[model samples]
Target chain A: MTNADTLGALLLENERTRPTKPAIREKDLGIWRTYDWAEYTQNVRDFAMGLAKRGFGAGDKLCVAGNNRPRLYWAELAAISLGGTAVPVYQDAIATELQYVLNNADVKVIVAEDQEQVDKVLSLRDGLTGLEYLVYDDSRGMAELEDDAAVLSFEEVQADGVEYGRANPTAFADAVAKVKSTDIALMAYTSGTTGNPKGVMLSHGNMVRTCRTFLENEDVRESDDLFSYLPLAWVGEAIYSTTVSLMSGCSCNCPEGPETFRRDGRELGATGFVAAPRSLEMVLSEIQVKANDASGIKRWVFNTFRDVAVDIENRKAEGLPISLGAKLKRAIGEILVYGPIRDQYAFRRARWVYVGGAPLGPDSFRFFRAMGINLKQVYGSTEVSGLVTLQSDEMASPDHVGKPCPGIEVRIDDNGEVLIKSEGVFQGSLKMAGSALATLGSWKAPDS
Target chain B: MPAASTAGEVTLSVSGVSKYFGGVRAVDNVSVDIPKGSIFSIIGPNGAGKTSLVNMISGFYTPNTGSIIFQGKDITALRPNERAERGIARTFQNIALFAGMNVLENLMLGRHIHMKSNLLKACLYWGPNQREEVRHRARCEEIIDFLKLNDLRKQSTGALAYGFQKRVELGRALALEPDLLLLDEPMAGMNSEEKEDMARYILDVNEELGTTIILIEHDMGVVMDISTRIAVLDQGTKIAEGTPAEVQADPAVIAAYLGTSH
Candidate 1:
């Protein structure tokens, strides 16, 4: 919980303290392949060294576009580890959308996922004047890729890094030692539902503080397992799955693919999970759809126990005492309904889950609570590294997105807009590049 | 001619393949180089001999003139089962699953070419057969899990809906663990949502499983979305072959299939 915590230092500490503990696991072809803290750090080192060999140095931006692969997360850390900034774009972004992000950031190197993304980048290469190299993760159909020097597979780069490390061992460690707390770590582009997207530049200190605050305030611990199926471009994913995992020494599991997410979750028995409101609604509606076609007897059994559980929840929330009979009925409901429902959705081990990005509907919120799932609402935008206020367990409500998290001060301005100040707040957006010097002048003044 | 078996190299190549039904030439000379781990689609109007080309690759029909090279091996004269043994799996334009069999059983049957337990061990249901069955069941479960068909694992194929049956057929083909998968109109008879789902699954099988796919479909939207490259077949003659964007822009393809409106 140091004030000057950087992601590189956090990872180094984790590697030194818990080298054998699982840091990341990816389900590939129906098997969970784990990389311990040592291996995790090694991969990051290799990636950073690889970039260094390719002329990627301080202040360079590496654009990442891919599914939530372990390599993508590590690439982000690798860039930050080398005093560079990582910019991740949504995997499904169209050509025009990607063009805006890449061009705005003036990214020199782009690490894409597969042939689909490689094609998109190559097609837009003529428009992107600054782009120099294209690093692809999956090499399928890449034989036809036209450019030789521009296109390099992830494996090829890693191999180059390994060779470079063999030739110069101390260089990698020296680079890591140079990374400071205030250095920009990653830039997250907002979804831009309203208008054009903006790149929010977050520092290493911001991520470390947000993760450390969340870790200390919540029930999360070293033993907690997180299923990181969310888009890597999202700030929440970086905070929870990457930074938090590094800070807490917990294992983060990447699902095999979108189709096998539920099965992967069940296999991991993840204790902590996070999602946006829309994702939660989809989960609840899927459950409702399944329950709608249930037979009369089954529905009656489900409903009777669900009522008991909901009653117990309402009484608990109201500060009223629950009777012994009601408690027994709730237990019965747990066995008959809640247990199976939770097991089916792979929420059996879910001790803490969060829904954010928008206010969740009361019906879905209450439904998860009634089923004894500790679902909470988190309130924040990407500009704050995705954590400002979080609903505490005892004060859980669908409407209110809870009190301010640790180290955050909130106020309402005369214009009726909520303003928050926190260590986790981003340095600024890339759009403010030209005005940075002017802003710094006023920022350093005692009275303005 | 045998080519080197290299990653991302041509996994299957059809060299001037021609097929004839007596006097009628069902398929004229056609050549396509299907790369490894790519979704290569064949599209045209009705009666375009797309199925005949698929049959020739799957060994359901022998080519009158040309050879099929797969992984550097010439397999033009191979039988269907022999081709299946060599890691070639395909689904039909029409549903070809056994209606009487349950979903699990149908999927398990796809592994028949891979099973090697002796008859005595299979009948005894002990030792090698038990271990083999367990191994195969686990593999089938992976396919089922991949396809999200947990609810219909035990239901008869006939009792399931059309879309479910199509998914089951895909699951069966996936059970074969093939390196090359041929899907013929996998989204046919499905609604928009189901079509989207099927398209995603197809992409998953191609990208995740690293399977080389040759697809034939009438739905241009799904094809354009899923396929890395496409070859247009108009009236049994190959006209254009390139990336989705290139194929979409090809004048011959636009004139023959997409029409002037597109």
Candidate 2:
């Protein structure tokens, strides 16, 4: 693997090495549309040129708000190529919350996914003085605003990029070459449960190194597929779908919309899966609801095999060896119950499934493991560029998030707070200087 | 209150139309004008001959008396399929989608009248027939995108939720690409959120495609909000026809439908 420091350089390297390999897939018109590495980089180049033509440049922020769309991901990489930082806003944020994040970031260009998001942005336009352009990917209900000065469709901007690229052929390559590892690549805003949200600025090196170290410790490869259905505002989504895919050359699959997440996930048969505890609970409950409605004979078969699998899992967890008879029963249980359950939940091919963002219940955790899923818990926050600790295969349990990742040091203070020191730690908050450093330094004295 | 003036050329004109079923007058001398590129809604209580009047206009039930004119052409003797070919497409009060077929197949069925490949050519599935299939599929995909039915495109219509089935029915009608669209109680049996989404899609279809619409709805709030002109029908008779404000303030309309207590 190439040691590409910046995300833009990584994308360029992939395009050179594996131009025909699928880089991204999105479900559109009930079909999986593929974009190879060459097309992926070309889209980023065209969009970066378009942004430059519209006066977006170095250090400027481009706010993307919507579902996990291919265009939105490409927009993020395009901004990074132009030496700008991408700020992803939660798609479901209310107008006032959106207004706060947009104005706080001083975003110059906003790329919205569809009419719903476009309306949210336009409703707050009078208060956003720094906003220069409003770009929308879907044009379903935007026919009336075609001539509006401030609004432009995604195609129109891309067309402008084509024209600009024709005139200045080498401009996109030169811009990609200028981005440095120390430059800020992303500015993800916290959910702001306490007060106003703060923008966490992460440099290119922070993201690249963290993804590289994490991928090296795991078994992720170029052939792996990841189902990207999470909110783009979440740092975990940015890390796995964008940074990790760029590092490993894996394809990220996007569902058609929120309503089709499970269906699309099953269709993709993703090899790597990431979900929060709440999502796992939802899946578990769905299974229960379906099983409750099954015929008596089917239910009996399911229950019997499930109990057998769970019994085997408990013995293994207790450091007990399984006898040959018990092992044979477990194998039968795998074929009868666990195999079908895994296929139904789209986890049949998942090799590295991570559950994070909250503590998953032990019952639900054991239930998935009994169904032949390698479900593990990860621990981190946005401030540390997504992950600092991941549970190893043998240490898989519900209670503890396992050891610190490579290149990370974790220590517990006398006050019972965990302190982490790593190269992946964010540089600083966007507007608040020295606060993050101060918070980390305050806990460092006890350790010393 | 002043009458809501017609915006442009009259698209559909029903003059003195009447329908009868076993000596019972279903539609009695109903006459209304739908202007081009306007959303005109017809509202009334149950059994007020609202559906009868719409069926007569769509050529489902031929008027026993009076003539129907569309864009200055007399179409009183035309069949339902003939009217559909004349740029008039409609959805039923109850969803009329092909339950056995998926969303894409049902929408493609709507384009049957436009298909030119004969049986022999279609069976061969080569040259012109293949190109035609591709072209129609592209149009269907566009309608799917417009209505946000990409997720359900491959799903059976019978398996869809009530709201989504209604949307698919609408998408099928849209695949016909009609000039004047008819929607019969499109928001019936919907929750508030689904009703709101249907209203948005209706407005989008009208504004984006520049298609004239004739909507028959029971929700006064929705009818009042979206209609460019309002027509109130009661007992197979036209009670009042004007702007939403004019209809709401009319003595006959309030006493018959909106109630006079307010």
Candidate 3:
């Protein structure tokens, strides 16, 4: 086993090697603020101190609810550094849903994104007596808010962090020590695609180990760029956008909102992208609709290239090399055909795409690859930390989950439920207090 | 849709054009010629088939019949991107700016039709493609300054107000540097002041740039003031076509307006 002790130590390692590299690019109001490796480590430190100053030290649990934004992530890393666990409530979680997570985790402090999010917390605050202070990041609508009941600005907290960090040097490290891989990092509520949302406690090790295992099989570069619009509270996004990004020192681009997705996705030209079937379906619909408006000559060219793409796909599907004639033709056609089409879709830099959240149709899967866009299906959940089985571009597997990730050992039980045992395997069961540390338990057969 | 097959001086022309959505015929048989520099206006009530007729011309929708002629070529079979390449640009019924992009980046999309380089050149960031990109960026900036969007140049379109967003959409259409500029209700939902501002901008776009202008507008005051020629459609057919005063007095136009609640 490659003994990497802790998540904080991993961050430190990346900091030393890639201090100047951008770790996060928060596209705010059209302005890109780069949080490089060095700055990122320090910001997480300050965030830990700030939380401590706000009365959340090691062993204290907190709740954060927000869309995919930089401050939301910073708050998470900060919470982690301070040895405090956090319950990530969905951004779209209504008052009752928020009530369940907050009440269950017995949250002491809460950091919300905006007034709308804070209102959700406030709606349930009467029931959540454990909640002490409400930290709101976006103050856009809060300026006119008449009720301050227990509200505090995120800026004010960060300012306190500056003062707190100055006074207590060992406070951050001390907080981090109590946070082992075995320590539960998040109480992610299940998406309930099948049933009601269940709080799945994932540990630091569960997250990092799964990420590292995937890394061993797939190639991820430090220079890779990503557009992280998926909900931070979703386990899928946390694994790809947060854990994987932090591990590789990759830059994560946060779009302004869902409305600006296509424009933002085009602008970022992200090297690694992941989405559910719906998101991919929406984009593909636009591409086809727009292509329907092409001129005769342009349409002809597009058809020829699409044919070439189909050939490429078929060859790979049959495990055959592209014929010499086809190769020569494609090289020539690239000038008149494929290159412009790829640029149009802004998939020029895309290394590979993962679409899970639901089953992806074979036609949908092959169409992207045929056109030289590497997209694959991944199967896993919040409990498994993103992907346990993912297909690479050249392999093009159908009807199979393909191979398991390096360290994640998977076995199908009699009930047909896949059980994964690995280095970061969390023993945190749903039956226990959701925020409790992982208990290192074996997989049990599901009850009828 | 008629083929854009006129032998000479045919910038954009549509003949025998009609559009049907299920049982409702949005546009009836219509024929029109927009000269190289003429300012054409398509006006009618909400269901007057003005926008639908324009959509046929801009290659957004293929007509169930007739042909659309542009610059002595047949583009009846052309798609929107092809129309874009053949020097046709258009705005949307609702603003369609890339909200994640700044005003500058939105304008850069206009030049996308003009970019000659491929993805390889872009990914490697070298060769003649790189030179063209830099050159186009300078041109885009010039247009931004001209539009007085310099202050909001760096701001994301999402952060902008509706009026400013429409202006950015206009700027994006302008970036295509097309011979034909199609403005789809560019002043829709704007207040009087915003309308005036947009009217002035549209006039500058047509006059200063010498670009052919085709627009859909509900505001008759704005239409009468700017349109060189006007075509009115009712129930998918051109009911009236003439100078502002002539079309304004046409019985068919008045009856169509009276028949529908405008």
Candidate 4:
């Protein structure tokens, strides 16, 4: 149980314990679609069999193109279940941007949504030596297209599996066992806003260890719902929604499209939140601006209480223990200030707020904490499958990004750059390892 | 050779093809005739259900009530890929290329229907099925040469410039070798130079392959230049349909715009 490296094994164990518990909640057509742990396990197994029926084997690379959704997660699970690597790309990326990733990873298979994605893959069908198949999720506008050989719908693949599994029922489990921790689980290309993107290779071990370490420090229950908004290609969200959701017995929720989180997060009441600092900043800023427009007594009380709490947190951050007199004053401020504040944001029982992707300001950190939110910073990389080290709830700091995570050896380099090495540090890209990665400080160049 | 359906003699027909979201018609009671090899254009302003109309025609959406007949077959209930299989293909309003995949892979997705073996055999890459795979690869290379996308053959679809992305999208649509090609705002968000390139590619597709084109375009200049016949849609309803000159002179189309202008 402690040394589980394979994702397929980890999921099987959890399914046994909480078979009926919800595992995935994907928003489809303005509704949240729930898949329980048992159902999800079957889905992964069936999808893996389908992949094998579609000619996918151990060590295959599958490019998944879609927003944060359950099917996208299923694609990852299914791909992994068959000992294949899943490469998730941002849905908004243009055809040109995907060209490098497709070429470099030599993505043999693509699982995509809608005509938009299908068309893009079609555009680049010229020189791709490895790419041979496209499995689309949506049949919209695509019913006229036949799945003869190189392309298929996700459902068609599953149907093929019905007969395929009958022919070789144990093939899926065998492929799962054949998957070594050293084999790549996912390849995330760094957003190449600047130059060609570089693919960051993350192994099964790197991903599994990250999820385990984060869960060991914080308790996330089966009841907790995590809203997935960020691109799955991004490490922060993938860890929280994909890896962490698998490690901790929790359900990961994906909104319908963009801004879906904002429109529906209140309804979801996500008990655990993992988002970038930008999202946190945006929400807080909006709340602050709206509060400013509030009339009379409400505005006045909010201001006065917030002012007192901010001052107290600032003093504490500066290493000052509140005097007995100050502690009493702080308790009064907590009742007046923090309680109502937390209530407004629906953080009543919110267990964790993880902010990463960029440095979170000290002021924002203190403000969130003052409101009883255990907002912590997690420092990570896509290559590390999300976190290398994360701030604990007790010792969460804005200025410093907490201690080294379990199983990792961390050191500050000569150039004052943070260096992390562990069983979790991915073996790097399968194509052009070492050279493809350019160490730009702690951040590596993304595969273009 | 697959028999070529003759030009501009009504190869495609839309009989009241419509769509609704929570019972509000994005496209309502819209029908048109597209002659084989004719360049037909649908013109409208933003939120006038222009995109929705194209979506229905491209098989992205099913008409709640109506039939879309393409190449003498009822395709109203057909899915996007099914439509693609019936020689009906489309480009996007926003270029939807698989950005992480390479240029060649994008083109290969277009030939997805052309492959001979089952997915299982293709994945294994063996024997007779492998030869079929090689044959398709060679065919895709030809499409790449025709589009002049060979230079960026191995480039990531995500990293390509905007114009090239749009070009690659068009190339993908052309790969289907459609009897009727639907182009949704193909020149939107492009620089003048890029638009010129797209216009040329559209002309080539229509002229060389004798493919019927149903295009939704906001750019009047490009629409007027390329379309043999034009249809005007305003507020999800078809206002007029005729030759380019006839549509340009129609009073109802002008009144629809002028009435809304107030």
What is model 1's DockQ versus the real complex?
Answer: 0.11
Q: Each prediction's Cα RMSD?
A: 7.5, 3.6, 16.0, 16.1
Question: How high is the TM-score of chain A in each model?
Answer: 0.94, 0.97, 0.90, 0.90
User: Sort by lDDT, best first: what order?
Assistant: 2, 1, 4, 3
Off by over 4 Å in 3: A1-3, A145-149, A193-195, A430-448, B1-262
Q: Predicted candidate 2: what Cα RMSD to the true structure?
A: 3.6
Error of 4 at A28 (Å): 2.5
Q: How close is candidate 2 to the true structure, as a TM-score?
A: 0.92
In candidate 1 the C-alpha lDDT for residue A304 amounts to 89
Query: Candidate 3, residues A1-448: lDDT per residue as tens digits?
Result: 2345456666667677889999888765454678888888887777777778867876567777887777778788888767667677778878987787777677888889876798887778789868888889876446534367578887777888889989987877667766687777766777444555666777787777878877776778889998888887788777788777878778888876655556667778889888787877776677677667988887777777777877877777878888887877777767776666566666779888888867777766666776667787787766666666777765655456567667656777777865666665554545556433334433322321
DockQ leader: 2
CA-based DockQ, model 2 = 0.43
TM-score of each prediction = 0.75, 0.92, 0.63, 0.64
lDDT at B99 for candidate 2?
A: 96
Model 3's i-RMS, to one decimal, reads 15.7
| Candidate 2 local lDDT, B205-236, one digit each (tens) | 88888888999998988999989998998888
Worst 10 residues of 4 chain A by lDDT: A439-448
Off by over 4 Å in 1: A1-4, A191-195, A433-448, B1-94, B98-111, B119-262
